[model samples]
Target chain A: EAGVAQSPRYKIIEKRQSVAFWCNPISGHATLYWYQQILGQGPKLLIQFQNNGVVDDSQLPKDRFSAERLKGVDSTLKIQPAKLEDSAVYLCASSPGTSGEQFFGPGTRLTVL
Target chain B: DQQVKQNSPSLSVQEGRISILNCDYTNSMFDYFLWYKKYPAEGPTFLISISSIKDKNEDGRFTVFLNKSAKHLSLHIVPSQPGDSAVYFCASRYPGTYKYIFGTGTRLKVLA
Candidate 1:
């Protein structure tokens, strides 16, 4: 079976510029998630989507980050006015259910100058 | 507050030796624990998992032990191989939540 898929594995942008990442989850998966992983740290949950609805996004920075899963199969995460601190790998994952094993994508490494 | 932590940043073990990585969590509400292995430039892959009720779970050469009383858990890799060299992350999730809290991760290097 194919795993989660992400686009533009690497991205570079100047500070204050905008960037977007896309994710295509595994077939038939019901839950999708976006996470940010800074160097030397674990992936921090940014947002979660159960089908077309959001399940959690409390840790997300509302002022700069936003994500959506319109059809429940693919999702996109966007960062407007990116900051230097936002230079990190953005990972996308999906699970068959709300709780269980999660399959991850290669991630998009965003470098903000 | 950091709910899950992997105190050791890295570990090195000779081939055919045992490699033990530790993790500690502060939240008692976390009912499920998981371990994920990641290679450089690759996303993490699920390795093993254990529920709150089980103190131990093993698959192949990997074993995970949970000590609820101490709020500690560990991943043990026996007869370590070069292919096993990767960053290992521990994660915990509460029974009803969709979020999983992850540790900083421990990098294990197996020297041949």
Candidate 2:
């Protein structure tokens, strides 16, 4: 079976610019998550969605970062007025349920200048 | 503060030898732990996992041991192979919570 899919394997933007990343999860998966991974660090959970409803987003930067899972199949994460510190790999993952094992996508590597 | 910690930055072991990767967590609430393997330019893949209630779980050559008292866990790969070379991350989650805390990761090199 095909795994999770993400767009724009890599991206580069200037500070204060707005950028967005897309993710398409595995078929029939019910849960989706977005994570940020800085260099030499593990992926940090940013947000999670069960179907079209958000399950958790406590770590999300409300001032600049936002994400949506419209139909429960595909999702997007956006960072407005991006900062140099925001440059990192944005990963998308999916699982069958809340406590299920997750399958990850290739991730979008963002570099902010 | 990082809840999960992998103190070792890297580990090197000869092929056919044993590789032990260690991890510790500060949160006593974490009840489930997992290990993930990642390669350069690729996302992490689930390796093995052990729940807090179990002391050890084994799968083929991979084994995970959990010590709830010490809030520590370790992954053991016996008769290691070159294919096992990769970055390994330790992750944990509290019961009934959707979020998982992960360690910084340890790069393991299995020499031939």
Best by TM-score: 1
Q: What is the TM-score of chain A alone in each candidate?
A: 0.97, 0.97
Specify the poorest-scoring 10-residue window by lDDT in model 1 chain A.
A95-104
> Candidate 2 chain B: worst 10 consecutive residues by lDDT?
B93-102
Candidate 2 DockQ vs. native: 0.79
lDDT for each residue of candidate 2 in B8-33, tens digit (9 for 90 to 100): 99999999999999999998988889
TM-score of 1: 0.99
Docking class of 1: high
TM-score of chain B of each: 0.98, 0.98
Q: What is the lDDT of candidate 1?
A: 0.95
Looking at model 1, residue A5 earns an lDDT score of 94
Residue-wise lDDT of candidate 1 within B24-43, one digit each (tens)?
99999899999999999999
Q: How would you encode candidate 2's per-residue C-alpha lDDT over A1-113 as one tens digit per residue?
A: 99999988999999999999999999999999999999999999999999999999999999999999998899999999999999999999999884547899989999999
